[model samples]
Target: MTAWAVLAGVAARLCALGLTASAAWLIARAAERPDLSALGLAIVAVRAFASARGVFGYLERLAGHDAALGRAAGQRVRLYRALAHGPLPAGSRGAGSGGGEALTHMVADLDAGQDLRLRCALPAIVAGVAGTAAVAFCWALHPASGAVVAAGALAAGLAVPAAAAAAARRLGARLAGARAELAARVMDLTDGRADLVAFGALDFATAAAERQARRLARTERLSGGVSAAALAAGTAVQGLTALGVAWAAAGTGAVTCAVLVLTALVALDAVQPAIPAAQLWVELRPAAARVRRVVRADAALPPDERPHRPAVPGRVALRGVRVRYGDVPALDGVDLDLSPGRSVAVLGESGAGKSTLLAVLAGLVQPGEGLALLRPARGLYQDAHLFAATVRANLLMAKPDAGDAELRAVLDRVRLTGWLDALPEGLSTPVGAGGRGLAGGQRQRLLLARALLADPEVLLLDEPTEALDAATGRAVLAGVLRARHGRTTVVVTHREDALGLFDDIVVMARGRVELHDAGDRQPIGRAFPSA
Candidate 1:
């Protein structure tokens, strides 16, 4: 596809050069009062070249955009897979993360990949081919004129573009930083709009956002000035080259001199895109780097390419596992083992590595030094995002082909049956971005419903009941355990009400297991009869 795009671009530029030279020859020859037949062929050549230029120009655009869009679709798929299944970069997990900033990186930064191909590589190749041909054609007719055209092409294509790229590199770093700060400020205002109003600080936050906007505008003005300078430089070279070619070919006939001068002018214009293309190439490098950091799983450590499944399904084992964030250890030298169909309740205080342990089991974090064997697992955390979509649409993410009955069943289990019936559109109701339209308890139950629908071999829950009252939390917890019977389940919680339902209890402190006990379990109906 790329090869076809380049071919069409070269053909279009050459036809444009042919049209200019033919028109110049016809005008000069007609001034000599010659017969009509003497100028017939030149007139025909002008018309044919004029028509071909537009045709090839259209083909060039069609082919180039087709190739670019096709590649973009494939790139989006790979990016989604990397974020969903592979190890994430540091500080990208847990509540209050900068999801808005990460979204900017995914969209704006990924676009840089497309620009590298469409804008930089395509334009550079087309300019080189067309510029060389123009110089050689003029040189064959008149050596002095050819030398003038070659010098002008080098100045416009090489020297001016090089200077533009250098200036852009210096300003591009500062521009990227400004854009990131602006995105963060805007997201905070949107997420905390209610609190800002309640505290009487809305005006202050708006002022800060306006300040960021003004700074971004100032940087953009500076970038525009650089582009204007490159444009002026290219124009100056075109005018000077026309004069030089005319002087060199003075001795030749008037008709030939006119053709040579016009050819040089049009050829210089054809390669003018080189200047901006070089600048854009320099500016897009930093954005491209951001995308690379997220897509590559081995950013911090070498990846273990071997499959990590245990000998039996729904079983997990970890020995001497350690994970460190910078100088601080999140999980240090932990050993654990769980058999299939066992339910374990993990109790810990804040900063006890409870969340990090869940991450390790879900395969989002790889142990820096140790052996970890696990099965496929699913986790339900408090911060799980709910996209701006319909209720049915959100549920379909877990099971794409799920029917209405299946969705209703899961919602009933999570105690959302009444809420669903109260909606104006029932299953088709639209939830605002991040579930802003729902109450805290409603959002928690919706996420729990999604987790129940997934039903993976191993279930991991991190403070799943933190948003509800004690009684409702107990009832919801019981329903989940009852549904997940005959599977491996791990609950990381501080509540004591659900302890009687688990077969084992584990206490953790300072990244180490402080206690472990194999206790007897009561029947689910006896413990939580109301469930």
Candidate 2:
């Protein structure tokens, strides 16, 4: 990365040299034109110089662009790693629904940052050097002419762009922030759209999204307008410098009218790279906070560190666990134990700490004042993600080298065999997000299949059936009941239908364990009290 940055810097300097040389040669050629033979000689020399300059210019972009991309890639990797760390206090977990947006900003927004670094900073530095050299070149021929063109070049490319960049810095940041925000909110809106529609809150959220879109468009337009204005100022400087050269050329010496034209054109070109750079910086201004947010978040955690993988497997226990979410305490001094070959059902309301409790168990959220242990095993909390990969792939995520027979058996037990085979790619076939490829039943079954495949000591299920139909739920419940014979499972649920699968029952209310039982009544309507 350091080497690339250095090479880019050198290229910027080379570009400056090329611009100055091209300008001097052009001005000289313009002055000598008139006699056909003499003009041809000058034109030929100018063409050769132009060709060489073009090559150098291309080289500058080639070397510099890669550096920018490489830097952006490094940042993306860093941010993604931090996101993986869990075990934070419950309130802070899954705080950002716009996670995709943050990732987008890190990669693309940072790419724009690279654009500014290469196109603006590198060239501006180069232009400053070239402007000075062009001034010296003209001065050597005619001192007065050199001074004016050199000064004008600085004003056009260096000074003006720099000033505009400073002014636009805040604007750039806002634009970047807005773009990130737009991306994040879009992700949030999509992820939460079902909830919104179901709750009849679509209009409110949609209006907010629309407002964000309008602001982004307006910011872009304003940025463009600023850039256009900056370009005009650069043009004015170049044109004036050229006019001065033309006047000086009339007095004909080593430099003339032709040289002045080249000087003006070269000066104008200096402004081009700065324009992109300035825009990038401007966009970055708004997103700086977002960048910091992602980069600095959970800074203590490194991306490569996996939570310690315990070799043994058996159960997960939350003992004297106290967890508070936001201003409300979700799990308060709750004591619970789930052992291998047993399952417990958690009962609660929407704000009844059901989800919060699951998060603690899964290592997604940490207990504020207690021990959450995977006793000789592991557990997955509710809100566990299913990547948009193959059904088999999702299952294999827990045990990558799981054999075909193992996968088939697990799939069969969960009753996903029919749906998994329906796909054209079969096992390799992709599943749509949140189970788009599979029916709601299939998606839930796939998640369950994954837990079974892992065969962890303890399984944590939170609203696991929210996406499944009643029939599929029964199959899943049956499978869990079967699973209970061999492993410990803790389920967070409000509905009593799934209760029969558990060997024990625990009810959490006001962050307290409202009810806990080991033996069941063994009554007929075991799953739920069929009213």
Candidate 3:
């Protein structure tokens, strides 16, 4: 995309043009048996041009790839930003949210976009300039030969490529979706391999993956066939052009005729890239369209124009809020208020809307009716992911600028101080993906440490101590509540050990609050409903 890369491409192409022309001239002129001294210049010229061609080509590749990669990096950032706000790419929501399908969009689709600039546009521009110059050079030698070369260049550079592009355009429409489907299928098999084996459904998943692969292969085969046809047509055109030039130059001397015909043949190289470039352009079109759809969809969403409700730090209020999924309500007519520097415990069985209430307060889910006002909030879900990185790296994700002391403090707050000191690399110790290397309790603690690092105005924890032993769970919860003292915190928990730490307790049933009690007034056992 950079001007320097384009210039380098042109220079490289011109060098190729010169190398072929000079070599042809040298061979033809040497046949006259002229003085060895005269032949010396041609020999030197041939070598010089040949070497310069490689040098310029290397430079072109270096500069071109650098430019393409840089542009792709920036485009990737834009794509992420768009995806973050946009309607997520297909298969990037709910179950398997970021599996193979999203990976295809992020990686393969972006690669196709980069190919548009690096392979399609750059080659086409260089080919046009160098091929035109070659045509002009031929015209200087003889008008008839020039006419023949121009026609051949047009056929090779435009006509054949155009035909290929037309065919590719239709196939490309299906190619992007097919690739994504295949990736999703493959990822499904991989991610669910253990479960599939356990359930004896591995063969079924494999069969499905094979079917997708076949579909994708069929589309690719068709595209490859088109490219092959275009390549053959371009080669035929090159041969015909060389014959025409030779015939047109028959009246001229043998040396001149040889030069004209050979130049015409070699010059076709400059135009040759157009065939592949056209096909590449066609392939890129679908990918570009998909990316644009994501970005445009985000743009189409109405801005958050809701007037701000007057609220202080950590204050949250929901007035007759309701949320539903089809016929089932997750939250219904729920009215509650959370003041600054207060803590609440939300207790309920499954499907009682405890988690949904936290979702509302965190602004992750919008209520279908009534008002829900909240300040900045962060939630530590039960399924928080720990990346396959160092302890420091994982913690830094919550607060990027956090120093060693800050990280240590958060770890201490979550009662991981002894564990942190035991690690061979201390903060630099690496953890496995999804916390594979760490115990269940340690993973939960590490995630809690990350959530607490930011010390948000409002903290929401959805069953944070679910994975720990009863004793450890109680201790960790106590430590977390102590650290979150004087801050608004809402915790979803079934455990009764940490009840006294909260200012209030909310008990819900069937999406409605059944009881609201001050923590100190009610017996912990009575707070929960009888079966």
- Candidate 2 matches the true fold with a TM-score of 0.55
Q: What ordering of candidates by lDDT runs from best to worst?
A: 1, 3, 2
TM-score list, all predictions: 0.71, 0.55, 0.56
Residue 329 lDDT in model 2? Answer: 88
**Which pairs clash in the backbone of model 1?**
none
Candidates 1 and 2, the one with greater TM-score:
1
lDDT of 3 by residue, 260-330 (tens): 88889877978999999998887676676666555453342234311122236567778899989889999
- The candidate 2 region of ten consecutive residues with least summed lDDT is 85-94
Report lDDT per candidate: 0.79, 0.64, 0.79
lDDT of 2: 0.64
Please give, for residues 94-162, the per-residue lDDT of candidate 1 as tens digits.
213433345656776678878877888789889989999999989998999999999999999889999
RMSD of 1: 6.6
How far residue 226's Cα lies from its native spot in candidate 1, in Å, is: 3.4
State residue 119's C-alpha deviation in candidate 1, in Å. Answer: 3.6
Q: Which tens-of-lDDT digit does each residue in 34-59 have in candidate 2?
A: 55665565456556655655666676
